[model samples]
Target: MKAIYHILNLCSFDVTNKCLIAEVWCPVNDLAALRGALEQGSRKSGANIPSFVNRIPSNGTPPTLLRTNKFTSGFQNIVDAYGVGSYREVNPAPYTVVTFPFLFAVMFGDLGHGVIMVLFALWMVLCEKDPKVKRNRNEVWRLFFEGRYMILMMGLFSIYTGLIYNECFSKPLNIFSSGWSVRAMFTELQWTNETLSTNSLLTLDPNVTGVFNGPYPFGIDPIWNMASNRLTFLNSYKMKMSVILGVLHMTFGVVLGVFNHLHFRQKFNLYLVFLPELLFLLCLFGYLGFMILYKWLAFSVRDSRTAPSVLVHFINMFLMKGSGEPALYPGQMVVQVLLLMIALLSVPVLLLGNPIYLYWLHHGARNQGTYRGYERVQRGSVEDLSVTLSQDMEEGFALGDVLLHQAIHTIEYCLGCISNSASYLRLWALSLAHAQLSEVLWDMVMRLGFRGDTGVGAVLLALVFSLFAVLTVSILLLMEGLSAFLHALRLHWVEFQNKFYSGTGIKFIPFSFSLLQSGLDQDVLIGEV
Candidate 1:
């Protein structure tokens, strides 16, 4: 009743025959159904004249709308939370369904923690349509219930990443055949309990026969748990993965920009803007990503110390300094020089190309027969009139303005390429922090229980276990999960989507009889959008 009243208040009356006149916005594709519904309503009212829906051209920009079902609605809302995509432009929501959770999992990975999240999300999905659950209107739970599918995917991917991380509640899982031979060390030393060496840091060289077969086929090898240098191994592995994954994610975004240019029929942008952006990104950051992988393949554990610093090489490339580091591969210096030149060259093209193209196009239009539908004459009073209009058009697109716009865009792309790449390091930082925090809980709380032996110890163990469970769920799972979720959101919005998204389009708000008949609160309708 309230919706109907509000809608009626918004419409005006047709004074001619005392009929109501309402201007409603709707999609072109749904015109047939809308027409049918109007005709049906007219027939039911016993009106002699049929309803009319005349098509009128609108100067206002139409709202952006993407069709979504229950499964996709969650992902769409996630994208919308940042800002709505432009009309008829590229949609990022479909891709977000996969990327969003995978990125979250990279930070939130832990088999036990993931399993707990999965159970919570799974329950929400199962109880989605239940009346009792729906009636419960807690804002936080409602938000969670609406995005239950996203949570489910996040949990599932976390389990996969957890398997790769080989962590379950801060302890390494020995699910697969461990590549390291810990028992072999004991036998090689040939020591009884009395003759045990005081040295706690016995290094197991991978090159030593029978000591290491290979890395565990799945996750990190369990040998790292006992190794003193596990931090070095994990840090290098996670950081490298972060750069590779981040570069890939950003590159995919820039490729999407090409499609946007193609759709809009802007050859200038396709040739001048996106091309240079892609080149500049690949030449510099792409080279960095390539170097990271090359180091792993070129160097083995025995001679790893001899491997050069990737960061120092990258810095020196920018400074144009020849530090004379040993070549990792053939033609290394030549490759670096070429890459740097290409990247530097792309900046000038991006800065000047678009403005120059626009200048040529604007001037060339003055002599053309038809220049944007404004007729021009070489002589007579028409020439003076046409000159006035042409001048107006030219003034609207000033050369200085075009140049300034292009310059800002060029600088943004060049700088964003560097900063966004660095932003991905958050993945490594979060993963390490989560792992360390979980480890602390186990060592500080659970370790006490295991060390005790008497009756008081049994009672103490139970209390300690309770505390561990509370902290793990409340702090690690809930708090850390939320933190990862927000960071993932930032990555998608600022780092990934910024390559393509403009978010200038308004949102679609179509009126429907179903909405009126459903008797839903205004808040419910708002939430749906």
Candidate 2:
């Protein structure tokens, strides 16, 4: 037995098909002779294997060749950039998608509609193997099957946000307007015998039993009321929250950019890249934080006193901002100035600090590599190699990459924001659709004015109409939901993915499935065969 270690090293080879060339790295340390035999066999089989060689990294000797290929050359481009700290060779795509649930819920939130989406997404997962749907099956099936947990979680989030917005299928609830009604709705949910009906039915009788137990003095009724007939606060608030979150999301993009720059040995560029984003986030967060406190408590506690006045200071702090008007006093002005200064300076400090640290790390690493490279270059060994440097390369940002990046980000953000928002709209659209359809069903039952005097013909007609209404609503739920699901994924792939990800990295392929071989297998794919 031979003691050997295995490591994955990429190699490129031309296979039979031009459109599907194979490039893979394999481990074959113990199979050195097998690799040699394979290479000889491949040549005899008329397999194309390009040569890639380096002067053997041993004592001074004439340039010795090791087998590699044109495809390996491309793989080297990716690896070398990673080694030098280029755009993270591997994109953090999965992480970006993780935030989708939060984004969608903020935009389209309603428990009933979310349930509908969950069911539809589930349907996609179950029917993933259908031949007719295969073309449309990729991302939808990928998310439903591979990322099912995330889909469910996002649906639940939309439900939670809908609860906060009191928004369902456009059947809005003004929880803030009537505190007692809000309490009653929740109290009913707490009990097992909750009836979703209008307020007029409950008010028909003074009997408490009518409210819960017996056939009411009147009939079932809707207790909650919608404030607006047109635009609701729930929908407006959802959009505002989306905008705020979108701003935060973009800031995160810039911060990631800075980190990537640091990784790629571009220390100076890190601060320059991060400055704009940090400033944007500081302003956005500061504004949002102030608004949240003001809306809830009508409070703005600025530290006015130079010294702590103990209990009095604590009480007065909350009292100051509660006035609901801008302070004109000199003391309040001074406090505001100080706060603004601290917040403004935060951006510069954060932006500059990371780059300085990165610069130090880059220099330290460069010093070590240069020492080794310099030693070889000075000894006149490196110059003697037959290595040729190419200088005819076209430089500067390519129009194609810029256009690709910008076009992708623009579409992704727009569709992403709109569709995510629309998802919440389903809370209104579908839920309202549900409620309205339910109302139509009830109307059919009520229109006959059946005072226990109806014949069999009238009775049969009402039953048929009510059943038809129920079927119609069910179809609407499924149709609208499936549409939303498709739109949601479009935003994910085209809009969101384009922002930080690109179709650039070569997928990792193992060496066991090789069509051809090269002499370099001894040094590259030596341990894993």
Candidate 3:
């Protein structure tokens, strides 16, 4: 009904007083098809003459129409949920096809759990063509069915991350055998029974040859399973990785913005605004990312423990505090100070660059008596010119609003670098929480089944196993999946899109017989052909 009314609103009474006339806005490629359809409709209606069509040039921005088929539709809809893409703007949906699932998998990774998700989506995908299933208009089922592809992709990505984490049902798989050796500590160090008994825990020395050969061929070393400091190791790892990924993702968004500038031919924005913004982000956080990789590669196991913290180094760079820790490299002071100065300089440029340029451009126009385009006024006297300048400046471009908007924008980007970097920590937080909860479920419920033996014990084991299954599916898979999906959506919508997406355009709604046929419910409700 809304669609019908919207189309009706675009029509007007014809001068002939016997026909209604309507103007259509469609792509140039569709013009011939549209004319053919009009002629066919006129003949079918038994009109005296065929309908006429004309093309007129329009400079106004047309409604944005992004062509999408079944496989891409779901991903495109995910982007539209945030905001419709502007006409000619690069669609984030293309990239979201992969990033969305990958980020969700980061939070919800679990091989066994992902297998369950995969199977569920696969069932829906296979049954998608069934008429009976299609006719079943349960709205919730329809929503899930529509996104079967997205679900499948997320599940598959989860499997990959889970493999990397080497976790399934909260248990480490010992496929490559353990890397660390307690025996090496005792044998190589010549430790006697007395020495072994005195120590509560033995450390794996990476410096020694036999103690630690290398990383577990894949994923984490299963030997970490036996270590008391596993959480310490895992926490540091996941947190740093979250920052690394977050920085890269945001940088990509800023880089994407360059394309928008090029498309619009707004080189003023390209040089003054975007370049400075990009420089600012890279100097501060991009430098942080570089430091992360540098520290990982530079500090070998020999100095890993003694190596200075990246997080502390960053904080100290800002505070200009004492370098109490050992320098990671020589003459670090000069480089750190230079990068900080460059980052700080980018701030003023971001705050005032475009707005000031606009002000100057408009000011030049007003002084030249060419304000608001080529309506040049002859100013015979200085006093008259002064009056015109004051009026033009007041009416044409208000510098105050531009400054305010730019100030807020500049502050948001700068502070967001801090807060958003912290926001990515949720990736580590949820992943750890999911791992811990799943481990608890296994330890408390599933583990008991393995200890059972007798007839009664077997029965008890069966009951416990059933309970484990229910909890795993309901809490971990379903609930945690929802949580991860929402977080990933937030990351893309807020953190990713805000950097590049303007999203100020309205979506295109084309008139078509196919649409009317598909919208059977709306047609029936209207009760008219």
TM-score of each: 0.90, 0.44, 0.88
What C-alpha lDDT do the candidate models reach, one value each?
0.82, 0.42, 0.81
Residue 113's lDDT in candidate 2: 65
Per-residue CA lDDT of model 2 for 389-470, tens digit only, reads 1211223223344334334443444344334433333334433444455345445554444545558757766776676545
Candidate closer to the true structure by lDDT (higher is better), 1 or 2: 1
Please give the ranking of all candidate structures by lDDT, highest first, separated by commas: 1, 3, 2
Better candidate by lDDT, 1 or 3: 1
lDDT of 3 by residue, 6-29 (tens): 456557877776666775568778
Minimum summed lDDT over a 10-residue window in model 1 is located at 377-386
Report per-prediction Cα RMSD to one decimal: 5.8, 14.7, 6.1
Candidate 1: regions farther than 4 A off: 1-9, 12-20, 186-195, 365-396, 453-457, 512-529
Question: Which residue pairs does candidate 3 place in steric collision?
Answer: none
Ranking by TM-score: 1, 3, 2
Candidates 1 and 3 compared by TM-score, better number:
1
Q: Lowest lDDT 10-mer window, candidate 3?
A: 378-387
